[model samples]
Target: MNIEWSALGSVIIWGILIGAGLPALFALGVKTLAVPAGPDGERHPSLGRRVGAWTCFGVIILAIVGAVAFIASGGH
Candidate 1:
C-alpha cells in the first residue's frame, strides 16, 4: 500500500487547527460577553465585550456562508 505522508500530515494539522480554533474563538467571545452577578443580581456586558462578541460571531457566520458558497459552486 502507498501512503502520501505529507498530505496526511497537512490534513491532520489543518483539521486540528480549524476544528479547534473556530470553537475556541467563539468561546472567547462568550467569555468576553459574560458578566458576573452584582449585589442586585444585575449583569451588564461592556460595549467592548459586545463588539468583540459580535465580531467573533460575524466571522463564524461569514465562514459558514463561504463554505456553503464554495460547495454550491462545485468547490472549484
Candidate 2:
C-alpha cells in the first residue's frame, strides 16, 4: 500500500505542535506566573506578567475546547 506522505507530514507537524507545544506553553505560563515579587515589597506581579500568563493559559484552553468541538463535529 502506498503512503500519502503529505498527509503523514501534516499529521506529524500538528501532533508535535499540539502535544509538545501545548504542554511547553503551559509550562511557560506557570513559569511566568511564578516569578518573584518586586524587589521592595510588592506581593503581586506586574499587570503585564499576569496578562501574559493568562493569555498563554487562555490559548491552551481555547485549543482544548476547539479540539473537543472538532471531534464532536467529526473533525476533518
Candidate 3:
C-alpha cells in the first residue's frame, strides 16, 4: 500500500487548524466583550469591542454553515 505523504500532511494541518483555531477565536471574542473598555472600568464594553466580537462570532457561524453545506454536498 502506498501512502500519499503530502495529502496526509495537508489533512492533518487543516484538521488541527480548524479544531484549535475556532475555539481560540471564540475565546478572543469573549475576552473582548468581558474586558473593560474605559479607565473607570465600565460595565459595558466599547462599541468597537462589540463589533469585533460579533464579527468573530459571525465568521465562526459562517464556517459552520460552509462545512455543513460541503458535507451535504457529499464533499463534492
Candidate 4:
C-alpha cells in the first residue's frame, strides 16, 4: 500500500485549522455581542462588536459556499 504522506499531513493540518478556527472565531464574535445588562437593565452591544460578529458569520458562510462550489466543480 502507498500513502501520500504530504497530502495526508496537509489535509489533517487544514482540517484542524479550519474546523476549529472558524468555530472559535464565531464564538468570539458571540461573546463580544453578549453585553451585560446595565443598571437600567438595558443590554446593548457596541456597533463594533455587532460588525465583528457579522463579519465572522459572513466569513463562515462564504467558506461554506466556496466548499459547495468546489465540490460542484469536481475539484479533487
lDDT of 1: 0.87
Q: Which 10 consecutive positions of candidate 3 have the poorest summed lDDT? A: 35-44
TM-score, structure 1 vs. true? 0.79
Model 4 spans with C-alpha error above 4 angstroms = 38-42
Residue-by-residue lDDT tens digits, candidate 4, 35-56: 9988999878888988998998
Give the Å error, residue 4, model 4: 0.8
Better-scoring candidate (lDDT), 2 or 4: 4
lDDT for each candidate structure: 0.87, 0.89, 0.90, 0.90
lDDT of 1 at 62: 87
The candidate that achieves the highest TM-score relative to the unseen native structure: 4
Scanning candidate 1 in windows of ten residues, the lowest lDDT window is: 37-46
Shift in Å, residue 22, candidate 2: 0.8
TM-score of each: 0.79, 0.79, 0.81, 0.83
* Candidate 1 lDDT by residue in tens digits, 4-65: 99999998999888788789889988898789967898868888889999899888888789
Residues 6-63 of candidate 2: C-alpha lDDT, one tens digit per residue: 9999989999989899999999988887867677766476799889989999999999
C-alpha RMSD of each candidate structure in angstroms: 2.3, 3.1, 3.3, 2.0
Backbone clashes in each candidate structure, one number apiece? 0, 0, 0, 0
Model 2 lDDT at residue 74: 84
Q: Which pairs clash (backbone N, Cα, C closer than 3 Å) in model 4?
A: none
Locate the minimum summed-lDDT window of 10 residues in model 4. Answer: 25-34
| Model 3 lDDT per residue over 1-76, tens place | 9999999999899988988899999998998899755777675888999999998899899999999999999996
